[model samples]
Target: MKSRRPKIVVIGGGTGLPVILSNLRDQDVDITAVVTVADDGGSSGIIRHYVNVVPPGDIRNVMVALAEIPGIYKDLFQYRFETTDDFFAGHAIGNLIIAALSEMKGGIFDAVQELSQLMRVNGHIYPAANEPLELHAQFADGTTLRGEAEITAAHKLIKRVWVETSNHHAQPRAAQPVIDAIMDADQIVLGPGSLFTSILPNLMISSVGKAVRESPAEVVYICNIMTQKGETENFTDADHVRVLNEHLGANFIDTVLVNTGKVPDKYIDYQRWDEMSQPVKHDFQGLRSQGCRVISTDFLQLRDNGAFHNGQEVVHELLNLIGQPRFQKDSRG
Candidate 1:
């Protein structure tokens, strides 16, 4: 008889989440990705304006990452129309499908579930919220930016960030499944994405934040290899965990994955990897101060002139975290 697969719930958005999920699929684990809905740029932003649904770009990418199909069909789902088609230009076929399903199902949560089946996704994919969410950032100088694109484009030092409805009044919400996934998971992972915009937006949701704080699951944060332009200009690995703890109002992260690999002085091309400034500085002592067990490894890969965590190596570390005292959750579903 087969045993149950260890369940892992990854909470974040952006390109990073998919890399980790794609790698984790090789392991005997159940995966659930909680993607950020704070996107308001490019195809996602334009679609959100038209349909009033959570931007599908991040969710779509995650779906493709976890999809268990041939490369040709995956390419079809990701295909974008040429600029010659004025209206559909730059929109991914997968993005359009997600929007249509959202409208048909009356919410992004249901749309993703139905789409996940068709995609033959190995695990669940859920948007962080039910409705559209806007990202708001307060920079070091105390000025504020309204949207994800605007904040990243500003190239300013971000002091803090949070997410709420576009109107800025009522609190944002996470679907019941999102919270349940977190609370019942054997381990919860965060990161390898934007600190403020990508990871924090999902945590900033009221119930999601509270559940993360209260969940018995071991929370492992995979720190980024390079610093983002505006989000994490000169941050250390420990600084990343500090910001997440501050935003969530608790030191909940149990383990942090730090890349010990060094990038050559001029290794990164400024134009190709424009958003990143430099390698993320590491402060092992600082991480110790925060009660986090730092797992440093040569988990770095330079791709397309950008520094990224070695996805396969990162997933190995995550699997190791399971069954350990620190990562062991006391409760069962």
Candidate 2:
């Protein structure tokens, strides 16, 4: 008889979640993606504004990543409108489908599940909340920004972020599954995404934070290769963990994976001159002092199109971490 595969819950939203999920799909692990619902841009924004639905872009990305469908279906789902019109341009077909399903099912979570089934997704994808959420950011300069778009475009240092409504609640339907997944999970992985916006937002959910703090699963954090321009302008690995622990409380993460290789000079020059983004400095000692172990490796693999991370290399590192003897030990220590 074969041993059962480990259950894993990946928490984040947007491009990063899908990349991680896509790499893990063929592995012997059961995956659950808990996506942040604070997105208010493009097609997602349109649907949220018009119908009061949680933006489905991240969930749609995960769905496509985990989908076992053929090439044609994948291409069709990923197709976006290329017109110059303000009404329909830049809208994703999958986003519209998910929005329509949410309208039919009366909520975004149900719509996601319905779409997952239709797409033949190998695992589950859930929104962090049922109600539409506005992402509000308090900048270091005492300036406040509302909505995801404005926050991303602020170009200022963000002090903190929170949901708009005090009465905002995690979709109990979404929380229950997350809790269940955590209880059954052997490991939980956080990011390779934006530290403040993508990764931290999910952990900010009251129920989700409680579940993570109390879960018995070992938590792994994949630190970003480069600092994001507006979000993590000058953030180091230690800074990332510090903010995460501050938001989710102390002793939240177990292991942090850092990229150890030197970035190509050409890319570094391009980033400095073109993108104006800096490299994320890894401070292993700083992270270790905060009760988390550091795992360093050459995890960066940039493509011709400027995309980073060779999927197989990341999967190899993740699998190595999972197979470690330390991984079986108590994460609380």
Candidate 3:
């Protein structure tokens, strides 16, 4: 009998998720991305306003990352209209396609699956919820705000976050396939994105959170290289993990990948990457206190005057973890 490949489920949204997913596609693992549905910004926010479907920017990017199609088609799908293009200005071709497909298919979840197969995606892309979700946050200063954009722009420390429908009443839930993916995974990776907005929104869902907390997989967190101005300003690596643990009400993270690389002072262009504040401080004892195995190394890549994770290096470490005794035993059964 042939041996089954490792099942790795990555949960998060924003630009960071795709960086990791794109690299993981080259590996010999069954990948599933559980994307957050709480985005209310950019072309996605615009589409969400006019359409009743979940935002497609993150889903669209994830699809392209795992897609096995030709470069020209991918480029065509990602093409965005110029500002002078009238009503189509600033809209990515893929975002519009996802919205149109969602309308035809009756849901974003099914639309993504259909598009995934059509695009020849190597793995699964599951939205955290079927419907569009709004992210709500309570700041450390005791103020409240709704919408991911508003929360991030508030520049205040977030106390808690949760998701709700457009009506702002009903609870959000993940589909069974998402839950099954989480429950049966050999490894579950989180972040390289905003701690509160991108990652926590998916976990805020009741069923998704419950499944993650109960899953036997080794939950790894790809901690961001730098702190974000409005989100994680002056945050240490441990602070990031603490926020995640607090929101879930458990120290569920099994391992954390920390970047020890130093970015040159002259390299970062604050004007272009205004959201980035400073390098994340290291707190080895603090991370160990939270019951997380810390893998601190130089996982940095500087490009376009911004700092990002070297996806190739991160994916290599992720694949290495799959061979551990615990993950090996779980995969066999």
Specify the highest-lDDT model's number: 3
**Selected candidate, larger TM-score, 1 vs 2:** 1
lDDT of the candidates, in the order given = 0.89, 0.79, 0.92
Candidate 3 per-residue lDDT, tens place, 214-306, comes to: 888889999999999889999999999999988888888888999999999889999999998999999999998888888989999999999
Candidate 2: regions farther than 4 A off: 84-87, 165-174, 268-276, 305-307, 327-333
TM-score of 1: 0.95
Question: Candidate 2 — what's its lDDT?
Answer: 0.79
Return the top candidate by TM-score: 3
Model 1 lDDT per residue over 1-333, tens place: 987888999999988999999999878999999999999988999899998889999998999999998999899999988989998999999889999999999999999999889889998888899899988889889899889999999999887888889777889989899999999988989988999889998998989988987888888999999999977888998899989888877778888999999998887998987888888998999887877888999999888766888889999899988878873333211
User: What TM-score number comes out for model 2?
Assistant: 0.91
Candidate 2 lDDT by residue in tens digits, 128-155: 7776777888999999988888898878
Error of model 2, residue 278, in angstroms: 1.3
lDDT of 1: 0.89
